[model samples]
Structure formats: structure tokens, C-alpha cells
Target: MTTALTQQLVDLPVIEVLYSDLDNTLLGPEGSLLTGPDGRPSARAAVALVDAAVGGLTVVPVSGRAMPQLRNDARLLGLSDAIGEVGAVILRDGRTQYEWGECPGGIARNPHDTLTATGAVDAVLDAFPGELRPYEPWHRGREGGHLFHGVADVDAANDALAAAGCGWACLRDNGRTGGWEGRSVRAYHLLPRGVGKAPAVADDLAARGLRPEQAAAIGDSVEDLTMAPQVGAFFMVANGHDAPGTIRTPGGMGEGFADAVLALLAHRAGATRDNRQAPAPAEGTVVPSTVLVVEDDEMVADVIRISLTAEGYDVAHVTNTAAALSTIQASPPDLVLLDIMLPEVEGWEVLTQVRSQPHTAHIPVVIMTARTMPADEVRGYNLGASAFMRKPFTPDELLAQVDGVLQDTPRA
Candidate 1:
């Protein structure tokens, strides 16, 4: 299934602000901060963020890192603003400009005193003994949240915090704890009950006179999920933990996931503006083209449904090959969007079956799947597929291909 991230991006929301988590979401698998030859963040990602910012999208770093680390990242990425310390601190123009509640900011400060939080940190350390060690930033009095490394068991640590009667909540560092060459000692953050990335992000948006629907968030861990409800859309990097209704990027370990998203947004924005100026369709046009989508992923199906519907096409989606065949037999659609990866009854077999049948043989079929090898594309075309689209396609590209195929094929 297509992920929630894909659906939202495909629908082309006007995202004025983008909140990106650092660590695994923007950094390389080896934690490299250097841009690639293309001057983009990673090898696979495009350098569209610069264009996005130039086009007026505010790209802000929202991470759990301390102020110093956040500043370094902002410098490297050419970003000017960030929310650090797990939402306790905010930086603007390379300076620590605001502290959630302590400073003049829209977000209310956590009512719990830092002293009380320090006590909770002490309790957890004492309970876990040698197992839990404070991260270096904590010793420097980083505000917003206290971080610790060497957590062997997150649940047990949370239990210890609860038993100590500490109101602070324990959040596992999902970003730093996973993927290639990941940290061996898992990290956890202890924050006041009401403090999170979401509230801090909300404050930033409000300060800029923007609403939640005008922003989007990208993160690679569970902590990032806290901000999901506060934004128009949330993107989970490929290496991050899975969450329902989040857009999933194909790139992982900061390998251009952010860049890809920015590129899609920029493309969509341009398309929308051009569409606005383009001539309208003739009056009383014939029924819009009907498309049959054969894919198992509901998220992907939804993306196709929304995109095709917006372009004035009727779309019918089926999850399996059996249903696809039944629908075609009952009422053949103008075109078929087939995916090779099906639960059972592979799409190639379906293609072959359709081609051998006289009634359905004339219908055009498009192959849209993650299997993008040359051999796969060749095999699909050999089986009479009309067009081939790789996974992670933009809405504009999908529509263009559909239009091309329809224009080439003679209507019966």
C-alpha cells in the first residue's frame, strides 16, 4: 500500500513550512553532514530544498539535539531556524532566540520546574545504576528535555521513573537507535509531561501567522510522531518507525528523502499555478476516462484515487488480481493501473490473462511498481503493458503517462 505521506504529497497541499528532524532523517547513515556532488544532502536526494526555501517554504530543523548541535546542522544545511532540546529551545539566525516557556514564545512552558526534572533524572539514573548514563548535553544544562544513553530496556526505565513518582515521561531515541552502524547503547529522553515537538512547532507556526494545515513535518522516530497531529502532513523516513497515516519516503538514512519530498512539492506547486492559467476544457465534454487500479496497498490506491479524481477521471480500485479480473469482466475500464506485487495471483499473470482475452485485450494497461529493473520493464511491455511507472511517482507524472496512453490508443 502507498503510505500516508505519499497520499498527502500527491494531493499537493500548499505546505508553507516544513519541520524536519535531524539525526537519521537528514544525516547520512554514517552521520555525514556533507552535501553530495549535486550539492544536495544525500546521493539519492535532489537539491530541491534550496529551491523550496527560495520559493518561500520555511524549512526548519526540529530535533532533540542540543542548541550547539542544532546550530552546526543549520550551518551545514544553510538553514536559519531550528527547534532544539526536544522542543524546549528555539534558534533563529544561528542564535538561541527562545526557550519554550521561559522565553517570549507562543508555546507555554512546561509547568514542571527544571529542578524537579533534575530530581527525576537522578532517580532514574540511581534506579538503573550503571545501565543508564546521562548524555553529555545534560551535564551542560540543556533545557526542554534531559537525555540519557545506555538504556538497555526502555519499558523498565519508564517503570523506574514511574516508581520514583517522577512526572517526567521517558521517550526512546528512535532516530539514533536504529539502522546501519546504529548506536549500541540505546538513548532515551526524559521530558515534562506536557512538553513535545508538536506544541513547540505549533508555537512557531502561530508566531509566523501560519496554521497547522500550512505546515508539514518529517522525522525518523517515535518522538517525531508527537508533532504529527500539529501539521498538515507528516512524513516518516524509510528507516523510521512505522505509523499509520504518515507519508513514507522511499529513501532512508537521510538519503535524499527530504529532497525528494521538496522536489515533489515544488513540482506540484508549479503544476497547480500553470493549471490555473491554462484554458478550461470544452463545455459538455464526454464522460471522464475511467481507470481500474490494481494494487494491494490501500495508501497507494488512495493516492491514485485522489489524483485521478482531481484530474476529472473516474477511478475503481481493487486489492487483488481476482477482484481486478472480475471488475474487468463486469465492466472494463478505459485503462488499468497494475502493480506487480500482489498478495496472490501476480500482476504479470493478470496482464497475460488480459492480453489473451479478446474482450479485454484492447484495453491499455500501465505498470506501476517498485520493481524497476530493466528486465522487469521489458517483461511488462512484452506482456502488452502500455506504460511503466516506477514507485514514488509524482501526481503530474502519473497523469501525464495516463494522458499519453489514452491519446495513443484508439477508443472502440
Candidate 2:
């Protein structure tokens, strides 16, 4: 589809936001565009990001695509400068901005040699009938690449290839499923080994005059882990609970990415506002409750804290994961009222951490957040949470859920 190219965004300050990887990260399973219930591209977050960039945040998408396809996607998104092929090609405002790491005199110079080798590789893939399905020829650099998604026995496939004089490796781990389930695979035959997504993002950020600490990276795969830790902040999509260095979001894919971005922006915005405003809780309370209030929003945290205290339960309030963990260590509460969105650390990570610890693992955690998706609730249950509740819930309903969980026998 046609996407509007952004005109000069001169209104906001230029803050750089760098993203690594496209598929399963920035681009959902469908593509870069996310579909809403009505089946149209959900541009709310994308528009928000664009507005944020125009307002002073610089947004850059760094991926492993070849120049041609990368350029196509950029045109579609109206992205000006993007780092492609993991920094092999850098496009600034729709032009080749800079070239570093296997570019200039490197990979791009040997596309022909790479293509020949890729043809040989394809021969091996073609040898196995009904075993591997090649989606299409993805030509970039010297090696031809193909994306596949299907069910196959790793051991059997390896053995078959070995028997057929062809060698193959599975780059995807447990995260490979769905269209690519047993069949989903990513194979590269060009450039050089050890050329991953992180270094590309890092180099591009440096070129853009941004520090890793000044930027945020959000992803949901082994590929993303390569760059997540290096950035100032790293976030994992909620579906990537098993993936390392990723903090779960209230929503999945586009929504999760949006949540992560907002969390950082909100934190930054709050820091600026804090200097001018007197430091105080949104609503101060001294009530007590056996229920622990674990919300990042100060107002919500205070309201719950005061309301629970007034209800005659010993109340403990903590605003962040570090403090909340410390509080739980000192004294385990009867229940945990958790918000899915939190600063620095996410609510799901906190819940996972709480459940992992023997001292507090059995305590029922009731998720309280604006994330009210069915998949999100199912994921919470799968993660061992007792019950999930959305935000703006009545104190009475909150109390009832808390009572029910506290009264029930702890799961072994």
C-alpha cells in the first residue's frame, strides 16, 4: 500500500530512536504495518512515533534487508534515514547517508560472487523434495536468501541434508513457529559470518550522534537480544517472555512496541516535569493492606495504597521493580496488585521474578492494567499468574479478587 512520505519535521527537537530487525520486531508477522480489528493498518502508534520524531525524537529503522527492498519499505513508511543490512547501507533523509561495516568496498562490491554461491546453496535446498519450501528468491549482496515457514524435524532434516551432501543450520530457536513453525527458517549465503543486527544498530546510532544510553531498542527474538542490552533501554514484546533481555509489554507487536516507546517518553517527560514541580505523590495515602500495590503510575499507586489501607488491610506501596522486590524481600504480602506497564522494569517481568523466588512464588498476582487483550490474559495465565484484571476496576471488585486469591490454597 502507499504510505505518506514525511515532510520536513522541523517542529520538534531531534532525538534519535533506532530499531533493529524488522520481521517479528518492528514488522509484525503480516509486515511492517499492523492490522486492527477492522483489518486496516493500525497507524496509531506509527503516527504517534512520527509525531514524536517531528516533535524532536529521531526515528531510524535499522534492518538486514538489501538496499532495494529496504528502500521500498522506507518509501512505503516515508522513513528518511534507515540503516539497512545491519549498517551495510545507511539512508539519511532518503539518500545513502553513510556506509560502514562490510559496505563501500566490502559486501556490496561482491554481490555477483555471493549470488553464485547462493545458487549452489539453493541447489541443495532444491534437492530435498517435500522437505523444504522456499518462499521466494530474496537477492541481497552476493548470497541469495529465502524465508521459510513450515513443520520439519530438525534432526531428520539435518540427517537428510547430511545424507544428500548438503549442509544446513537452523538460525531460529524456540521463537520459530506459526508460518515458520517446524518449517520457518532463515538462511544466509552472502557477506561474512559474525555480521549480526546489533553492531549495525550501534554503528548507525554513533553515526547519527546518539549514544546507546540515549536511545531505546525494542525487539522480540534472539536477533533482538544482540542489540537490546546495548541501548539505554531495552524492551521485549509480551509474546517474547522466554526471550532474554526483553521486558514484556501490555500488548503484543505494534501495541507492545508503542507501550515500550511511551514508557520511555513518559519517563523522560516526567523527569523534565519533576524538576519544575514539587515532588509529591499524585494522591498521598497511609492506609494499610495485606495486598501489595505494584503500579508505576504514582496516582494509581497512591489511590490503591490509600484505598486498601482504608479497607483495613496492611498496605505496602512500591513504584518500581527494584523497590517492589526489596519490599517483597523484607515481607511477603498476601497478594500483589500489579500493573502491566512500569518504568525501567515491566509488570510481567516483576511477576515472573516474584514467582521464581521460593519465598514469594506462591503469592497470587492479580494483573491490573489497561492491557485488556485476550492473548495477553492467556499469556498471564500461562506465566503462572492467578488472575488478570484491567485498570479502572472498582475498589470493591479489586477487593473481591484479592480476597478470593488470598482465601484460595496456594498452588504447588
Candidate 3:
């Protein structure tokens, strides 16, 4: 049934937030989602938070782990929306939503055995005997993929696996997947050739009546790196493992995850209001410091709202840039959170118009987006943005960047 909270969210715009990496990115090192838990997420709290965001926008947890195992956790966590196996499998509302790259013909014979699911893994292990370790299934009645605990030569192992039956291959980053009777550990996400998180989440969104721009993907590993660039925002939680161009979080485990979620929620909150009067003259800006956050994703918009509200900023969040532009001309906000993908007019065109206008040109615009390419960043900055930041950032960080810019304005 639609709860009161859900009803409230239904009225607001939505932004989807896709979190990758259960070990640390979503939970903690130990897979706990609670605050006091050593590893991070305790599972129960994770479900509650997700439940709260359901009607507004979907909260999808994407992981590289096997589907069944993650499914079990999903059941335990009550994650109505989840994607597993680096996006090869998907489950929503506790039901198997979709499975891709698993050829029906190849699996038609086995039916019961998921062995066909581990073709790429088997091939990689066969080519490099000593480098790969195979682990038994984590559950019964299931023939799962073999885990490679420690490999002396990753490059050699990958080359060998390439020649094998063909599937996805990922270097292990977490040591949880026990291989070789629990000898060593590393990060990995090997899967079928066509399988990946972007496709999986994208498919999930399509099924749910959402789009890529309506969602945000968060991760801290190579697998996520492959998917992050495609979403509205690719948040890289700073949990030690580093990637170039990634927005680093201040803390580790739950702190980093919470920080990112909070930032996204702030965006959502900022965009919820229908009529946002700019900040009072005393607050600065002749037209009032109103904001228009243009985001179609509910989860993202909610997070953005939380952040913007916390800063004592008033905002009007909208979905389409075209509608946002019309509103701007009618009543402009002091700032705009423009996403590149939008109906009718793209975010770039919106930015061009914002800069070209005589009245709106001087308004401060912060490009809060997930476009990570250097060219994108350069383009955002070149377009006269006060600040440009990729998605999945912490609210404090986003606020800091915005506050720094607004502080430069002469207070009215």
C-alpha cells in the first residue's frame, strides 16, 4: 500500500541511485550496513533506508558477487531493487527481474547447475593452473563459479581465460570469495563477455520506467569504473582503492557511503519545491538565492534536496531542462543543477542559454552531474559554471564547493 511517506515522494521528482560494491562501497569491509558494525552495513538498516526511498525513486544495489548469494542477502536485507553478478542478474521487489548474457541454449541442458554461468572463470583457471584457485559453492543445490584466491600472474591468468569458453573476467579486490581452500585474496568481477553493471542497471531502470540519467552509480573499483561513466553520476567512494578523476569521499566504509547518499538526497530535497523564492535580499542576490535542480532521477533528486536544505538554501527541483528553462525565464533561480541528458533540450544547450542571457547569465550555475570525462569537465568549466562536480559526492563537499562560490558574491 502507498504509505504517507511514499505518497509524499510520489509527488516529487525522482532520481535513481545505483550503489555498487557491497563489501565496502555500500556496507563495510565485513558486509555490515549498520553504523557500529565493524565492516559497515548491518543489512537491517540498509533495507530501512532503501525502503524509505522506494516511492520517490528506486535504490538498486549492484554487486559483482554471484546472483544466488546476493539474492539471499537481498531477501535478508529486503532490497526490493537489486542487481548482482556485475549486472548479469537483477532482482526487484524480491523477484527475479531479468538475467542477461546467460544463453538459454547453453544452460538448457544443465537447468539446475549454474556451471554454465562460470564459463569464463573456468577457462581462466584452466589456462593458468597455479595462478587460479577454484572455490566450492557458498550454498547447496547449486554449482557456482570457482573463486580465484591468489594468482601469482594476473596478466597470464587473464590471457589464458580469454582463450577459454568466454565470459566476463574481473580482478578480485575483496578477499571474501574463498578460493584454493582459503589461501589468498584480491578483487575480481569476471563475467560473460557482454555482462556488466551498466547494462544490468540500465535494464532494471527500463523495466521500472526509469532512464540512465535518472540514476546514479556508486563504486570504488575497476568494475564500477566501467559502469560509472554511463550513468547520471559515477560516485567513487574513497575506500583506499584509487582511480583517476574519481571524487574521493572523506571517510571509509559507512561514512563514505552515507556521505554520498546524503549528498544525493540533498539534491532531491532541493528540487522538490514547486515555488522557490530566491534567498532574501539580506541573504544576497538581487533576485533572491533560489535554485532549480533539474534531475529526472528520484533518488538523486532526494539526496540533492537533503544537501541543499541542510545548507539553508531554497530550491525548486524539476525533471526536464525544457520545463526548467521555461520556469527559469518566468522566474529564474540563482543556481541550476543541470544534467547533460534531458528531453527536448540537452543540459549543454541549457547551460549555453543560461550563459548567453543578459539577466540569467550572471546567475551562478553549478554543474552537478556524472559526466566524468576530462572533456566533459573542461566543457562544463568553459561554459562559465561557477563550479562543476561529478555525481555521488557528499553533501558537505557539494555545499562546500557551492558555498565557496557564493561567498564571492557581494551580499545584498
Which candidate should be chosen as best, given lDDT against the real structure? 1
Write down the TM-score of every candidate: 0.55, 0.48, 0.54
The 10-residue segment with the lowest total lDDT in model 2: 1-10
Name the lDDT value of residue 258 in candidate 1. 52
Q: Supply candidate 2's per-residue lDDT for 250.
A: 56
C-alpha lDDT score of every prediction, in listed order: 0.69, 0.56, 0.59
Ten residues in a row with the worst lDDT in model 3? 1-10
Over all chains combined, what TM-score does candidate 2 have?
0.48
Winner on lDDT (1 vs 3): 1
Q: Candidate 2 regions off by >4 Å? A: 1-15, 32-41, 86-88, 93-135, 140-190, 271-412
Which sections of candidate 3 miss by over 4 Å? 1-14, 35-55, 97-99, 102-125, 129-131, 137-146, 152-190, 274-412
Q: Rank the candidates by TM-score, best first.
A: 1, 3, 2
lDDT of 3 at 247: 53
**CA RMSD, predictions in order:** 10.0, 16.3, 16.4
Q: Write the per-residue lDDT of candidate 3 for residues 146-252, one digit (tens) a residue.
A: 34455545566566655664434433333444445546555444443455677776677677786666666667777677775566666666664687645565545
Least accurate stretch of 10 residues (summed lDDT) in model 1? 103-112
